[model samples]
Target: MSLKWVDVQEIAIQLVDSRPGVDPRFVNFVDLHQWVLALPEFNDDPRHGGEKVLEAIQAAWIEEAD
Candidate 1:
């Protein structure tokens, strides 16, 4: 399935799966944005991933990591 910026939980799961050893708490928005774009299932407009969306993704990822 394709992923959009609104698919925060799914994106977080994907991030956890893809970057196994990484800590989401230490991730910056810039890297988080790029990582979301790089996900194989992600298929949304890069411009649509704004700061708020990135923040949500990061928060979700942190939860998934825990």
Candidate 2:
């Protein structure tokens, strides 16, 4: 099933509170960007998802494109 906006926000909050893979505090969006960068697809291109984690991994989507 597709996630609701609430679900997405909750996911973002969780990303902030817990370590999605490394550490919590995603610190800055840059940290989040770094995490994303370490991923295969993102590593291929730091701008793979454009700018936001939401957009980068939104059930295969992001919040912003650039």
Which candidate has the highest TM-score of all? 1
lDDT of 2 by residue, 1-66 (tens): 333323435444444434434433234456555644444322243454354444534433223211
TM-score for every candidate vs. truth?
0.96, 0.31
Number of colliding residue pairs in each model:
0, 4
lDDT of 1: 0.94
Q: What's the distance in Å from true for residue 1, model 2?
A: 22
The runs of at least 3 residues in candidate 2 whose Cα sits more than 4 Å from the true structure, single-residue gaps closed, are 1-27, 40-43, 52-66
Q: In model 2, which range of ten residues has the least summed lDDT?
A: 57-66
True-structure RMSD, every candidate = 0.6, 9.3
RMSD of 1: 0.6
